[model samples]
Target: MKIGIEAQRIFRANKHGMDFVVLETIRELQKIDQKNEYYIFVSPGEDKCLEESKNFHIIEINCPTYPLWEQIAFPRIVSKVKLDLLHCTSNTAPLYCKVPLILTLHDIIFLEPKQNDNKSWYQNMGRFYRRIIVPRILPHCKKIITVSYFERNRIQQTLQLPEEQIIAIYNGYSKHFKKIKEPREITSKYIQAKEYLFFLGNTDPKKNTPRTLKAYSLYLKYSDKKLPLLIADLKEDIINDILRKQKIEEIKPYLFYPGYIPNKDLPYLYNGAFAFLYTSLRESFGIPMLEAMACGTPVITSNTSAMPEIAGEGGILITPTSEEEIANIILELEKNSNFYQQQVAYGLQRVQNFSWKNTAQSLLNLYRQTVTS
Candidate 1:
């Protein structure tokens, strides 16, 4: 079978969750399948991460805008390739592709009820694009894939699709995520402190950055240890704004902005951290939670959405909306060594359940089934 996978942003220097998922899945596919011909579609990027094997081909499609790239340039390329099936790794897909579609709808957070008032032009445009494209493309897609069972149910109910139509395939962390032998070498470059809580945050409203800062402030107020927080992928100005808005500017000294850390160095950061904090209001699957766990680091995530489902009994789960609850968890983890070690042990065991090899096998099966049908 000739398969086309839309991994538009895979080669980009700064990649997010969906990009990593597609890249890892493709790499695993290269390892597992030797007979099926595969084409990976991507935009021009600085990072040439994936190397083409005998069965796999990397095709770069360039255009000025995202809409034009996906809608016009992408489909034109797809038509020429004449693939048996095209898997749109990202949520949105070309509306008019002739090939059968398999969409990985990571989440329906945009369709969810408004929880925060944070908005950016880039975010708004992306949301608008998904809003217009998802519903239109659903009918045409042969199968729909999501990252978690929680999101599968939400998509099924909201889009009114059958349970069988939308299947949940959980995301997996890279095998590189493991305990770092020399964590101090990496940690020293980011912060002066030997130990600090770590968080991966951005301007995305669902990340609950403001509330996290508030929680961190409350933790500092009550706890005597007062561990600093090292936040990645967020600008200092944005962090300051959040701190000011939340009226927790006093905790500024305890906050460290590490700018953006590369994917290669993340395992070291996780290993060195006192604890990994992820209190998103909603998520389809919390990849960072598992990444931290894979590094044998204890995690503090929210109780809502797929957090509990992904974290299981491994990480400390708290109410994302409550600053006090998050603060209390921080205190508990710091004060109680037995509880902290238990979480760390559980996380190490839990991470073994997920892997890119397993995810790729599931996707490969689905592709075969879809093409034969």
Candidate 2:
């Protein structure tokens, strides 16, 4: 089978959840499947991470914007390639696809009620675009893949999709995100603090940054250690604004905002962190939670959405709005060595269940089944 994959943003220097999912899956597919020919469709980028192989090819399509790129260039390219199947890795696909289309709708968050306004114009626009495009394209897709069963039910009920047409395939963390020995070597490059709390923050309202900060402030008032917080992907100005709004200006001194941290250096940060905070208001599947767990770090995430299912026995699930619970858990992990070690063991064991190889194998099966049917 000749398969075409729309991985538009994988080549970009800065990648997020969906990009990494496709990138890691493609890399694994390259290793596992030698029988099928594969073509990865992407925009030209500085990263140049994916390479051409005997049966695999990289096709770069240049466009000024995402809409023009997907809605315009993608259809033309798919026609030229005459692909047996085209898997749109991102949420939205070309409205007019020629062949069997399988879409990996990571989540249907766009269809849900809007909460706080987004900080970035691009994010707000992206949300708007998905709200318009996703509904129109779903009927055209032969199969729909979502990241978690929680999202699968939402997609099926919210969109009124047929049960067989959509299925849940869990996302996997990279093998590189493992326990690091002598992690101080890399952690020191980002922050001077030897021990700290790690939280991956962004402008998206669902990230629940303000509440996390509020909880951290409460932790500071009680905890004797007073460990500093290391936040990535958030600017100082934004952090200051959130701190001001939450009325916790004291945490400003305790925070080290590095703006953005590259994926390569994340393992060290996770390894050195006293504990990882992922108390988000919502998530389809929390990849960072698994990444932290793989590093043998205990994760504290919200009980809602797909978090609890993904975290399993490993995570300390607390209500995102409960500052007292989050703060107390942080203090408990620090003061009690036995509990911390037990959580660490559970995390390591739970992490063993997920891998990119498994994700790729399932995806490859879906491609073949769709094409053959």
Candidate 3:
């Protein structure tokens, strides 16, 4: 089978979800399907990441990723590839493609008008594509892949896509996400080695960043222990100031703004943290929670969406919308040592169910089915 994959995001992303999905899946698929010819199509500015192999080649297709380019230029690129099947890792696939197309819809955030909040003209234009165009063209695709069952359900309900047509492939961790010794030489400079709760994600509306800060404030206000809170690269200034005013200072001996910790260092950071706080309002699948679990870090995440499903019997599921609920959960995790240990054990066990190998195989199986039909 000759598979033409839209790999534009993999090279262009600095820190993005779709980039990881495309890069990791293609790497794993290459190992499994040695006989199948694979053509990776990326944008003009984006360089090819994959090496030329027995059945793999990278082809640069000059096109913008957003606005009209996706709807207009992308299909032409797909048509030119002349693939048996084309898989788009992002939601913005060509509305009309000659070849059978499989699209991975990570989350339908744009579909809910409420989630859009107030944004600029171009941002809203992108949302228009996601909300209006994508749903209309969904039934045209051969198959759909979503990161979590929650997302699968969302896509089905929002776009009214068939249940069987959407496959739930849980996201996987990098091999380096397992337990690792704290890099004291590095971590000592940023955090107090192992004496802080960590929250890492974009400070956007859906991530509940303001609420997270409010919850942290409450935790500090009520809880007796003076444990530090470590937040990484939150873009919002107002939230950062709130944390600062609440006396969440930089670890004195080390420089602040740990910037972007590499994948290799994530396990160490997770393992060393007192606990991992995930306060996202809605998540299809919380990959950070999975990484924390893989590192045996006790997690406090939301009670809704795929959180409970991904959290398993492990971790503390809090009502993310409620600051009191977040504080209470944090207080409990910090005070009860035995409960903490139990959560850790449960988290490790929970992570066993998710693997990239399984995800790749399931995706490959769907591809085969799509071609055969």
Clashes in each model (backbone N, CA, C under 3 Å)? 0, 0, 1
Q: Give the runs in model 3 whose Cα sits over 4 Å from its true position.
A: 44-49, 115-125, 236-260
**Can you give the TM-score per candidate against the true fold?**
0.98, 0.99, 0.89
Better of 1 and 2 by lDDT: 2
Q: Could you give me the TM-score of model 1 versus the true structure?
A: 0.98
Q: What C-alpha lDDT do the candidate models reach, one value each? A: 0.91, 0.92, 0.75
Question: Whose lDDT is greatest here?
Answer: 2
The global Cα lDDT (0 to 1) of model 3 is: 0.75
Q: Put down candidate 2 lDDT per residue, 55-173, tens digits, no spaces.
A: 99999999999999999998998999998889999999998877889999999887788768786999889989999999999999999999899999989999898999998888899
TM-score of 2: 0.99
Model 2 weakest 10-residue run by lDDT: 110-119
In model 2, state the lDDT of residue 123: 89
How close is each model in CA RMSD to the real structure? 0.9, 0.8, 3.2
Candidate 3: count the clashes. 1
Order candidates by lDDT, high to low: 2, 1, 3
Q: Order candidates by TM-score, high to low.
A: 2, 1, 3
The residue ranges of model 1 lying beyond 4 angstroms of the native Cα positions read none
